[model samples]
Target: MQYDIEADWHLLNTCNYRCGYCFFTADTLGDKLQMHASPQQWQSAFDATDFTWLLHMTGGEPSIYPLFAELCEALTKRHFISMNSNLSRPLQSFVERVDPSRVSFINAGFHFEERERRSGNAVFLENARLLQSKGFPLLVSIVATPSALARFEEAADILAQAGIVPIPKILRGSYNGQRFPEAYTEPDRDRFRKFAALAQESYREMLNTSGHPSIDMFGDIHLLYGEPSFTGQLCEAGRRFVNIGPKGDVIRCGGPTVYGNVLAGTFKRAKRAKPCNTGGCIYFCQKYTSGPSGPQETRSGFFDWVADVIGTAKHPV
Candidate 1:
């Protein structure tokens, strides 16, 4: 059977930090990225359809868009809006202005390299604590790397000590066109899973442990000690969800803009076109589509699918 439809419309390509692993990394968004979507296009897209359960507003960084608040106000008028932000902005002002209930929760991604090297970690932590204290629903997203696991736990500890509860969303490592898998040797995955299990015990206990609400945006959230299990049908992106790029480009999936532009037509028609860069789709999305079946083939069932894409940054270009 087919599935419910959701749309992830990429509002702009403006971001404050140029993260290494981001799909719309500086290098990637370098040429095509722009803040240029007409009001007519917005209304047409909004009026032309009905299955937009979640209208995700993303950017190089949504806060920097200047008109983010206006966009949020516009979309919330029609759909349940979720703005994917790095939580690096003092958005309390912005949130208060928009539809509070329509705003799902902010996905706070702590850019460690930037925080440590560029903007001191102390300030970063303080910003996070401030958001948590305000009682804004939030999801903490961290990238998975050799040192990532330990750093994540440390960050969690710091947040807890500050009296903040955060849900950890672990993402696979994607860098300069490469992807990292959770093979047996990665001790970090094991440590994380144990931590997650502890968080599941109770809500209050989870504040100290992992229970903030862990989600894996990619298939590697959990490590399969033996063989991985596959469930649900392979994702046919356009049918399930669609992402409209900044310049009116409608991509089949978030992997890479590899299809028609909805501004030129509707999602139903966009699906008929082919992805412009299908071969180079990031690993997080590429593995699901037509690949060899095996014990390693990861599952994209209802549970796993949404978690993998919901708050994830675009794969690094």
Candidate 2:
């Protein structure tokens, strides 16, 4: 029995589309970098810990990985397996390997920004339709841009007609240097609350394909680090979750620092240091403070893991 349960959402960098506002820098057009954990690498990660139940499998697009089905088979033996995808491929391919109950619904990243890319929406709808027909889980997740909210009614109608549920995500901009959105103001909050309530009531009759009846993975866990319930001044990434790259480099969490090659020694050489980068964490490393005036708090042990994981990021001057 594993002592502590940690959700390991691995990133196998195989992808298809190049979205403009991708969280991962390498997920852009110019930097076409793809790194996947080989069979040996995954074996090594599995051997490193005795986690009771493994979490889900995430990626740039899990379907793009040729060995995705094989990976699912191996994962089903030990953990609850789920994959996040853009729903650009055939559902039959995935059904051939994964079981419906064990798998969560697919998170269809709707390409609304690219209106001319008609196939984008078509493929997502097709995939959702196939999954729905087979009684498999299916969902639609869209990054709610300023433009999206303005046209939310039409979008919701389209998805509802296709027998899919839409999950609206709050899009936060780039890390450290980039500025946060100005539109996230008082009026927007009030409007959103009403919109969400109305949406829930209106779509109550629809059979949403995602995890939940409507939304699949709600809240900021996908963007923020740690569980929403985890609240404190620090986090325990090193002790809780170990993020290992293909080259055997261990980092506190998957963020900007990973590319810098901050090699903390292997898991066996776990040290006791504090992460200095805590002040400017870009990822959801901690929980969100509810009140406007409250000081933000994160999960426990975050600093301790960072201190032990690696050192400074040496950006080019």
Candidate 3:
């Protein structure tokens, strides 16, 4: 529930599934998986920072990372970890070796079409059930694309057979040569809302309290209407939360601000918040952007310094 810094770490891009709506292309997904460091090295780099970190590990499929269980095991020994995965890989090692308390959440992305094509529903459900049984905070979601929305009922039925209801993840990019959720018809929007509501009710406790940024169910709903811009808004992205690349380039949100590399032991945390210049993830934008401080702003005052941290970071993203 608490950590000094929460890193949005994009560990790798190799994946087993080729979901069309995914940002990664077939080549990117098929990219040969590689580990830039050992499990011990990654753990050591994180420990070098004097702060307790909540690492949000994501990828084309983080489960496919080399020595995944060992990496997670090592990291959780000193810091908390969260993840976004397709639930396709073996998880017995993860469930046994990693402590549930050291985990923030596991976003099980239910790629309905991909699972159906690969006949992987059984394994996916089995993994989800295992994680839930082990008391890990789990959230299941399905990307709401045109094809996905049309077959949502069938997908819901399939999930229902396993006692799972998936939240609808809105598409923010071009899908099948069409843009969406704009490309979605009114029927699509209506159907999406129904599932979104069901998903919200199922994980209300975690959704209301510590909604995972990767699967912000509420933010997904808001995105259903329209994407909001947060330019010039004061935000604490660099100071409290950071976006880390696969090779360990530390970025201040989606902007070009790089704070060295964590793996190379040169990363530095920003002293305070700054105005948001880049438009990126809607969850980060909405969570970190603050209400108007009004005009007549002066950064040289004591009140301004306190406001810099508390004004935007009081509510953890």
Model number with the top TM-score: 3
What are the lDDT figures for the candidates, one per model? 0.51, 0.49, 0.79
Off by over 4 Å in 1: 1-4, 29-33, 38-44, 120-135, 165-179, 182-184, 198-220, 223-236, 254-317
Native-to-model Cα distance after best TM-score fit, residue 146 in candidate 1, in Å: 1.4
Using lDDT as the yardstick, the better of models 1 and 2 is 1
Tens-digit lDDT track for model 3 on 1-317? 66788888889989999998888999999989989899999999999987789898888899999899999999999899999999998899999999999998888899998887999898898998899899888878888887888998888888886678788888887887887666778788778777777777777776577644444654465455445456777877898788988888899878688889989999999898888877666655555555454222222232233335434222111
The reply for model 3, stretches above 4 Å from the true place, is 208-214, 292-317
Query: What tens digits encode model 1's per-residue C-alpha lDDT throughout 1-317?
Result: 11144456677776767766676657554544455665445656665665454565666676766566666666666666655667666665665656556655566676665555566456556656765566555555555444656676676666576554333345434554445453424475565565554333323442344222212332234332221232223444555456667766776654454446555654452343232233222322333333335212543343244345443322210
Best by lDDT: 3
For candidate 2, write residues 203-250 as lDDT tens digits. Answer: 444434231321222422232222222223334445444354534454
Q: What is the C-alpha RMSD of each candidate to the true structure, in Å?
A: 8.1, 9.7, 6.6
Model with the higher lDDT, candidate 2 or 3: 3
CA shift of 100, model 2, Å: 3.1
